[model samples]
Target: MRLGPDTLGTLPAEIAQCGYDRAGQAIGVVHFGIGAFHRAHQAWYLDRAMAAGERDWAISALTLRSPTVAEQLGPQDGLYSLTERAGAGERTRVIGAVREVLFARPDAERAIERVAAPECRIVSFTVTEKGYCRAESGGLDLERAQESFYPVLSAALAQRAARGQAGVTLLSCDNLAGNGAVLHGLVREWLAAHSPDTLAWFEANCTSPSTMVDRIVPRTTEADLQALEERLGLEDRGAVFTERFSQWVIEDDFAARRPRWEELGVQMVADVAPYEAAKLRMLNGAHSLLAYCGLRAGHTYVHEAAGDPALRQLAERLMVDEAMPTLDPAPGQDLAAYARDLLTRFADPALRHRLDQIAMDGTQKIPQRWLDTAAWHCARGQAPGAIREAFDAWCWHLADARFVDDPEAKRLVRAASGGGRQTLLDACFGGGAGAPLWPEYAHLRPLFEGRRGGS
Candidate 1:
């Protein structure tokens, strides 16, 4: 039997099922990019909130690309299993927060209607870094904006405005610097280009609060599915695997009334910038470094690479020496301890996070993860040695003919083939030899060349 409303009573006693009454709940959040991360993190938090008696914040999830998620969850009545792994221990729970899943393309009209509903107070996103369709110059690429969620959002907002309805909060849960502000800016730009009349309404009505979400959710495999079946005595296509640790630091600036998420362990703060920067620079930066360097070192999984003495040292230095110095942590924030925790999380063998998964879309990720840190040190006349090495590793990864899955792969590969190290730096960082950090990068030519010769 498949895991659904009908099979809810058949689950094993040890496995926790959704304790809340799903029929009484209403959809208040329309989430974009319904991937594993969203299911395991934000949706999980809302699930807990529901379990604790908050009934009106169920999620209506939409997939921007593939229908895999929608197909997986739709048949299961928007129910799924979340497996949290910690060392040798594991816990399983059925999450009932996602009330429905819609494929944005085929169900475009219904998706818009859902977002335009007055009860929908929040429209969140967990699209990856590249999903924003950002340009190298840091603004919305109008040409690429057509293919992004901006158009759908604009139409929904327009519909709501036409109906004289209230505006919804636009929460960005992506791993980008100032994600909320960035998303708002892009939406404004997109509105200005396509729907000029909606621009003023968006500016006055909607709120995009920055958020910092943390969780290590690996891509689920056949083994995970098999294990879940054995544990639940049913098949759950929407099952997701993640680490035991999960956190959400949301900026307290919603336009309308929201769920009592604070009571559910969410940090509703005035500003998420400090937390955001620490996660992006320290945690994400180290992940990128590990991904590129670890893959080059023939390590497939994050734990394998994090356990390697040489790779671990490089990751540690990247977080503590390079990334940590650039952050302005919030009051009571312990960055050193945070870095230590991140290193330990990266070393969690049970998570089985793959290096290649982290390596995807390097062009979209490196600027926030590494280049910004390098620029910070360059402004201070100090070279960030760890970042430099990681940058070189990224270049090496780009140059490899093993099929990079980056948006700018062709451009990166072309740059990697010509003009030596400067050319590659120019392609990746966008400033060629004239960029402020060019000198620091150029100085690493000897190191890169030596690595080429197996030093």
Candidate 2:
């Protein structure tokens, strides 16, 4: 039978089912994105918190554009299975934290109403890096902002202010550097332009805390669905497959009462900057290196790439030598141990994380993941070798026929084709004058020329 409320009691004894009563659970969070990563990471944490007796923290998940997730979870009553894979071991659990799923397009009014509700204390987002409609200047692109969640959220906040209700926390769970501050800036910019009257109330009432979320949630395959069916005796279409390890470091600045997430292995801290920097520079930076260099080396999956001695060495060097030095880690946080743990996580044999998946939106990711680290070294009169190699690999990947997923694909392709090395560098780094590593780029010209000639 298909997994739903009714099938919960009939699942196999070994499969962990939700122990909490869903009927008594109240919707307190209105999440913007109901994607797989959110399901495996944030939703999983909230599920654990609920299972531990926090009943009012259930989620009303919103899908802004795609209706697939809403459809998948709606039929199941927001009931789905989470499979944590580590080597030969795996565990499946039904998560009931997502109480409702709404498609934001048709259900925009309903979603706004839900957010405006007094019970909704947190409005979280997992809308990816590009979803924020951020411009190159690190501010909200007013033109693009119109199509984002800003309008919907602004309307909701305006409603709440009009009713004199308490404000909600805005939590951004994307992988961008300073995600919370970026989100707040975007919201404020949007509000200032469109609804100037509401800006004061929002600034006074709301809190947007930065967060660093880490988990390797790959795209689920049909084999995974089949395994779930055979093992648990239920077919769950909205299932997610992720690695066993997960980490969430949140800034402790919520506007309203929140789930006791710290009790469930989440790190609640005063400043999430150090944690965020480490994650962006080390974990995500290494992933980008692996994705570009690994694909060029003919590896499809992250594990295969990580298992390669040369690629592994490059990854470790990038993390330990280049990225780690750029971070000011929190007290008691061991950078070396964290680097070692990351290598192990990347080598997980059970996670078939596609390099192409990580390769998508390279233009949006590379600045924080690599360029900033390289620039940091450049400022200190040190050239990071691994980053240079990774940057060259990225250029090659952009030129390849297989790469066409980035939002800036056409521009990058033009740069790769027309101006050769320097032009491409200028295009990516915003010209020689403004480029952070202009001098370094000049020094690397010979290397770029040789690689281009070989290709």
Best by TM-score: 2
- Weakest 10 consecutive residues of candidate 1 by summed lDDT: 446-455
What tens digits encode model 2's per-residue C-alpha lDDT throughout 1-455? 88999878899888887799888988999999889999999999999998988878899999987999988898899999999999999998999999999998898999999999999999999998889997766778889877779888999999998899998999999998888888988999998998888889999999999999999999988988997889988889999999989999999999999999889899999999999999999999999999999988999999999999999999999999999999998899999999999999999989999999999998788878987887788778888888888887888887673855887887777666665766677665444544432343344344334444212
Q: Candidate 1's residue-wise lDDT over 1-455, tens digit each? A: 99999989999888987798897988999999999999999999888888988868999999998999988999999999999999999999999999999987888888888899888999999889888987756788888777768877889999987888888999999999999999999998898888888888888889999999999999999999998898899999999999989889999999898889899888999999999988988999999999988988888999999999999999999999988888888999999999899999999999999889999988778767877787778778787778877877787787773637887777667666655555665543345544332333444343333334011
- The alpha-carbon root-mean-square deviation between model 2 and the true structure, to one decimal in Å, is 2.6
lDDT of 1: 0.86
| Collision count for each candidate, in order | 0, 0
Show the lowest summed lDDT stretch of 10 residues, model 2: 446-455
- The lDDT of model 2 is 0.87
Q: What TM-score would each prediction reach against the true structure?
A: 0.94, 0.95
- Model 2 off-target regions past 4 Å? 417-419, 431-455
